[model samples]
Structure formats: structure tokens, C-alpha cells
Target: MMSNSTGLLLHNAKDDDDEQSPFEEVAANISNKDDPTILCLTFRSVFIGILLTCFDSVVFQFFAYRTSPLDINIGLIILLAYMMGEFMSKVLPEKIFNITINPGAFSIKEHALITIMATSGTTTTFAIKAITVQRIYYNYPVTHVNGILFILVMHLLAFSIAGILKRYLVWPASMIWPKTLMSCCLMRILNIENQTETTETRWTMSRSKFFWLVVLFQFLWYWFPGYIFPLLSMFSFICMIAPHNIVFSQITGANGLGLGVLQFD
Candidate 1:
């Protein structure tokens, strides 16, 4: 009877495993969850998130004008947020006696949420250019209130359009974007405060250390293209040879209207 019962228990466990969906299993095993004390979204989240959004938007916009447009990587942003969030949590006062600004210690989830919010806000809306055109080209200034309203209306319309398309575009398993999956993994890794130590791995550097090293390399490298070696951005042969010819300058110059661009460093 005990043998039969053990066999039944094993069968039930197998059944349970079989019943679980692959996605469910993955979510259960791989999802990032830790101490529940840190709140994910708060007024602070909105504040910092919006600020990050604005900063990233401005930086990217400035670079967009360059001959070699540089993308402000979201991963770098996330890393920055992680470091900042961690620092702020340790330094900032949790609460000032009764009156509190920060209710509890900062959490990784908070950092992730802020990063995500800033990322979403980084994409400047189409309405912004429309407003810009009116303000600059036509010299018709849109009032601050009108600008806010325009943004609100545009976002609402976009959200509605997204909802309408989600059923057909997003529901299918095959439609899931690989980059999005990678983003999810990245977020999880970034937010996870404590990682399991592996003895098998021979690499000595921590991920955070590696990230900083890469950042330092990129930071130093950017100066070449951005300032020191301007030719690195666009080494136009025509610009070099026909530096005086207006027609050739127009055809190959990065600053002027050009027929084509050639970039090498």
C-alpha cells in the first residue's frame, strides 16, 4: 500500500510539472523578487523618472543633428540609474521623524521602474516637432497649457492605437520581440542586488565592475569622434581633396547639403 501511494505521489508531481506552462515555469524560476520592503512606484519615481526622461531626450536630440548620430544606450541609462538609486538609498534620509519624503529604503524595483519610465519618455512625441515648427518656422508660440494638453491628447491617442493593435500584433507567441526579451533579462539582472556566486566561472571581474570598465572605455573613445578627431565622425575624401570647390563641398560635405557621406577614422 505504501509503495502504491509513493508511486501515486510521483505520478501527481509529474502531472503538476506537465500541467505548468513553459512561460509559467520560466516566470516562476527566473523572475526577480526580493525583500518586499521597497516600494516600486511613488511620487519620487515620477519625479526622478521624468527628470531622466528629459535629460536623455535632450542629449539624444543634440546628437541627432551630428553627421554620425550617436545613440544614448538604454542599458547605460539603466546602469547609471542602478548606481544612483543605490547611492541615494544609502545617503538620503529614509524619513524626517514624522514628515517623510522617502518612506523606506530605495529598492531595485524602484530603479528599474524609473529607468523604464525614463525610457518611455525618451521617445519625443510627434506633436513636439509640430509645436516646434509652429514656434520656430511660423513664429506662432503655443502656450505652455496648450503644449501640455497637446502632449496629453497625443499620448491618449497613441495608447488607444496601441491597445487596438495589441491583440493582433502582440498576443502571438511568435510576435514577441527578441530585444524585448533581452531587455527584460537586463532589467532583472540590473535590479538583482544579490547574485548567486558561481565557483565554476573563471572570470574575476564583477558585472558592475565590467560595466564601469566598458563605460570608461566608451567615455574615453567618444572624445575622438566628438572633439579630438573630428575626422573620425566623417572622413569625406571630397572634403579633403576639393576643400575649395563649392560644388564638391556641397556634394560630400557633412556640414553642408551633401550627395553622399563617407566616414572612416
Candidate 2:
């Protein structure tokens, strides 16, 4: 009886240790907890999501024609959605036509849903590219109705393929994507409340404050490389030293072979 009890205790201890082991990247970043009461598909979220989607699609498609296309990433959309949600909460009346438009404080779930919708809209579909190529290069003009159908068909096909491969590609523990992890981390950081208690650091800044500061710094810094001095974008000292040397250009030039090239921008 004593021997059996000892063996059982050892087994339980092993299980406990396994439970307390270092978490996987997905588990570490994403929360497993679900709040049933949290409103995800509220009027405000849908409104903001659709609005941003239209704005992003138009802006992105317009920029696609430019030499340097501008892309509105998911992070920007997330931040924008949060601000809009907050604004609506404060300005909008509690009940309109006996319907709850602003459901108290903006929940994280709503923020996440809006982010997903806005991000989806920002992506320029392959169908658009294919249609453009067909029309311009092949000289095959498609009717407006036919173009819409073609886009729909392409999307449906893609969704079907994704559904089929999801088990192997998405559900597996080994299929860890760095980009997905980064997005999840950003979402968590944005949603989490700032710690009021000050730390012992020289500059005690909140997460949101730090994020905005970085954005401001990057915005100011980009002007130098992007417009003021384009050469600063790809400054290769070796190429400057030997402008006429083919070997040096091949090894150090940004447009060439670029063997030992380093870009600061």
C-alpha cells in the first residue's frame, strides 16, 4: 500500500511539472480565456470595421499605381479602430431608437474583430492583379458584372483551399508563424491597461506613450531617407570609394550583387 501511494505521488508531481513548463509561442502571446459577455459584433465595431475597410481598400489601390506604393498595415488599423471606438463611446448617446449603439466601454473582442476586418480589406487580392493583367496585356476586356463574379469565384476557391489545408498547415503545434506571433503580441500590448505604479527607471513611460513616441521618431527620421536625401537610404562606403570598379560595385552596391551590403534606413 505504501509503495503504491509513493508511485502515485511521483506521477502527480511529474504531471504538475509538465503543466508548469515553458509555454509555446502561441500560448504565450494569445489568451485562452474567453468572456462570453463581451460584445464582439456590436454596431460600433461593424461600423468602424466597414468604414476602415473601404478607406483602406481605396487608399491601398490608389497607392498601388504610384512608384512607391504606401501600405496601411494591421497595426495602424488596430490603433485607429481603438480611437474611433473610444470616440463613439464618449460622443454617441446611450440608446438610439431603443437600441444600444455604444455598449459601455469598448471591449478587446470588438477591437480584435475590427482589426481582422480592416486588415482583410487592406490586402490587394490576386484576382485584381490577374484581371488587370488580362485587361492590359492580353487585351481581353471583361464586363463589370463578369469582373465581380471572377473576383468572387477566386475568393471562394481560396477559402476552400484554406479550409482543406487548415488541419495540416494551421492546426498543428509545429506550424508557428513569426508574423502571426508579432500581430498577437501587438494586440495584447494595445489592449492591456497601463500600470499606474511607477518603476525605478529614469524615464517611466506607459506602453501607449512609448509606442507613439517611436512612431513620431520614425515619421521624422523617414523624411531624410525617403525624400530629403534618398542616397541615405542605401549608403555603401565601398561603392563610394570605388565608383568605377565593377568588382567593388558587384560586391557592395545596393543594385548589384550586394555581397557585404548593410542598409541603415
Candidate 3:
């Protein structure tokens, strides 16, 4: 997950700022015959692309159910949504339909927002699964506690594995995750820096707005579980306690939160 965000930030294909030396000759030749109309058109098209992504993400979240067509994986849906967006841009008429698709509309802020939404759903699903597994199995008593422990251990193992593989997968900069490529292309379209400067340090206005929005939200969101509503963070503990009662146990199983049957059984 951290690597995903890192890729969004360091997509050098989209941002020339990663290069130390500006391609001055290339820029000079291009600027000599620069077309403002083309630039505007490209920007418009890219904006459409970002909008399409946002729309697809939202639609998938709304209609995607826990089973059947709705049961599709979020990551798969995101990829499909991006493809659909790309397709629409190419096939859909711009003026006749009064809609345009452009990859330039995607910014760092938009990417982060989309990612957070996508990840939040995935996390919730995993958490629910962990709860289910605990209640169904471990009939030896203290099943709830054991289940919580199981979840923690599994997450720790996942993180550990990710850490072990990070050096090989992420450090060399050659692991071209395809989704990363799509994101980079969109980000590049969004950036407005003239191609002359290889390393422009100034933040684009859109990027600045997005950066602060994320910062503010991150600071504020953590406060709820971290301080104000601390119990929200201890949901698993609450779940364990509630399961000690018969009513809660019935409710748990009914709500699909109990792990009454383990596969091993």
C-alpha cells in the first residue's frame, strides 16, 4: 500500500522534474511551434479521464455487492474502470455529446483520494472476514480472543513479507507495475510545467490544493479514533466482549461476523 502511494509520487514518466537535466533542445524546437489550442484540447481530454476514473470508482462502490456481479474484487474493478474510461475517451464524441475525456485531469490529490476510497473498502472486507473466521471456529472456548490474535498475526506476517520483498521489487525502479504506468500517464497530463526545465521545484496550484487537503484530512481523521472516540479503534475488543453474551453470539453469526465453522473442521 505504501509502495502504491510512493509510485504515484515518483512517476517519472509523467513528471520531467525527476530528470536532472532539461531537454533544452527538444523544448526549444517544440516551443517554436507550440499550439495553445492543442494544449487546451489535451488538458480538456485529460480532465475527462480523471472524471471518468472518479465516476467509475464511485459507481463500482455503489453497485458492487458482496456476491454475484457486486462481488467483484475492488482492485479488478478499478482496473476495469480505468480501461472503460480510456475507451470512452477514444470512442465517445466530444462536442456532439458535450463531454471530453482527458488524462490531464488526474492529479496527485485525485489519485490519493481514489486510492484511499479503494483501500478503505478492501480493509473493511478483510476485517469482516477476520471476524467471521474467529466466531465460526476455535470452539475450544476463548474463540473470540484467538480470532483477534489470528488477525493481528496475519497482518504482521503480511507486512513482514512486504518488507522483505521491498528491496528487490521497489528499490531498483524497474518494476513497472502496469497500474503505476496508467497513473503516471495521467499525472503527466495533469502537470503544467513547460518541458524546458528538467527539475521544476515549484508545485502546481492543483497539486498544492490536493497536498493540503490530504494533510488536513489525515490529521483530522486520526484524531477521532486516536483521541475523541478511542473505542472506535478497539472494535475487535468490543466484539470479543459482546460475544460472551448469547444474544450477541446469535447476532454475530446472523450478521456474518462469527466464525462458527473453520475450514479445518
**Which candidate wins on lDDT?**
2
Per-residue accuracy of model 2 over 1-265 as CA lDDT, tens digit each: 5698899999975554344213476776665555689889999999999999899989998898689999787778888988998888899888989999988888888888888888877878888898899999999988899999999999899989999999788655556777767776776767775544555565567666777788899999999888998888887887888899998898889898766665656
lDDT of 3 by residue, 117-137 (tens): 443343333643546555567
TM-score of model 2 relative to the true fold? Answer: 0.77
lDDT scores of the candidates, listed in order: 0.70, 0.80, 0.48
For each candidate, give its TM-score against the true structure: 0.58, 0.77, 0.30
Residue 32, candidate 3: C-alpha displacement in angstroms:
27
Q: TM-score: which candidate is best?
A: 2
What is the RMSD, in Å, between candidate 3 and the native fold over all Cα?
22.6
**Cα displacement (Å) at residue 22, model 1:** 7.7
Model 2, global lDDT: 0.80
Q: What RMSD value applies to candidate 1?
A: 8.3
Scored by Cα lDDT, where does model 1 land?
0.70
lDDT string for model 1 (1-265, tens) is 5798899999975654444324653453344334566688764566678878888888776775479866777776776676767666667676666645565656667877888777875556788778989999999999999998998899899999999998677643334455656665566555653344578666766654565587699888888888898877776766778789888888789887755666543
Candidate 1 global TM-score: 0.58
- Model 1, position 134: C-alpha lDDT score: 98
